[model samples]
Target: MMLLDLFAVIAAAVLSVRGAPALTQDPQAAERPTAGVFVATDLNWGGDTLWIPDASNGSCIVLPAPFYQGTSSFGPDKGIACSLWYHDDCDSRNPSFGPLRTPGVSTQADWSNATYNPNSIDNNGIAPNSWDKQVTAFNCWNVGEDGLHID
Candidate 1:
């Protein structure tokens, strides 16, 4: 996102949190921000990076570009930080429900040429292994990627 756009988002978020009359309608209907996909060049959510914004709740997003070989995060939007996993196939076993997090070792020349199937993910920042690079599918929110709730 652009700097101004990001700033606007932050400002709006602050306003919403602080109860801006126009922005605040039903207090009980408030929502939390969603942290989308974050990629790092190194392991353990470290190194140079790139990030994709959160997809809408219950929506599936297939990356059309290349972003292979790196660590990942669920972002800090939710109340509690949690561990998450990713899958390679978009089948019954690898249903598209829940966010993705992973770090992997890839030998591909670039993001496009690289295969991204991160076998495992560790959001607790304590997994012994890195993310797998052979990935095609991932986990995301069961409801939507817009709220703070985890399922």
Candidate 2:
């Protein structure tokens, strides 16, 4: 996203939270900001949706309450991406959702390659290991290629 566009989104979000009307000539033309992960309460992408802003670099941010215990579905929007962990502090271990690459390594799938099916993800072959509705924490960063591994 462009600097001006990002600034506009931040300003608008602040205004909206402060109960101030947004500054726009046409209310219908103002697009909702799409610079973060979109988490839904219902499976198949339904029910309440929350837009979580990008986490500062290398920061281990915990998921918000209610969602901290479980999340039905989640997808990252353009410009920003992240990975979820079954435990707080971004630790993907046994019984935790992880990236699908190595045969049995605990890593999270990249945002661009997310399948959006927590249940299908390989956490293990058991209960909490199924990865369905089992997210406790996460890490996020702006999607960029420079100095970043695509895998």
Candidate 3:
């Protein structure tokens, strides 16, 4: 029927328009950027986004603002660099969900001053180190006001 054909055409057009970057699956993909922790900066994920938690930890990236401008500039003075870690919300190791493997940081004060590095290659949940792939459906976390940020 004409209606069926029209429906197919419409569906095809919709799919075409909805096309976005395909996330990778291999965590060690060379195209992926190295993970790093940024401090004292509000993240701009290009557009509004949410963090999907995984069984081991939550992984997400905050694309710098002026997204289309192809610039790496962030924060007033730029962000501070730090290490990375993975921890679940319910993780007994670090219940607050922060960097788990910080160098030279062993106490609360150290943690406060430590940097958190997220897996950049895992942003799309492709790489072996993907963080958000295991998130429960409809469950997500938002960035904080004054805490560590990752990309």
The top-ranked prediction according to TM-score is 2
Alpha-carbon error at 36 in model 1, in Å?
1.9
Tens-digit per-residue lDDT, 1-151, candidate 2? 6999999999889767633243222222334444445555545444444556544254677777656755666654444456667657565443334332211111233223343334434554444334555677766555453424232
Ranking according to lDDT, highest score first: 2, 1, 3
Ranking by TM-score: 2, 1, 3
lDDT of 1 by residue, 1-151 (tens): 6999999998889656533223111211335355444443333443344444464343434433243323332232333222223333334333122232222222222223333323434322322243333333343543334535565
Tell me the lDDT of candidate 3.
0.27
Global CA lDDT computed for model 2: 0.49
Model 2: weakest 10-residue lDDT segment is 99-108
lDDT of each residue in 1-151, candidate 3, tens digit only: 9999999898888656533222222111223132232121112212221111131223333323322222111111112222122322223232122333212122334334433233232333322332221211111122333435532
Displacement of the residue 63 alpha carbon in candidate 2, Å: 1.7
Better of 1 and 3 by TM-score: 1
Model 2 segments more than 4 A misplaced? 1-34, 92-129, 145-151
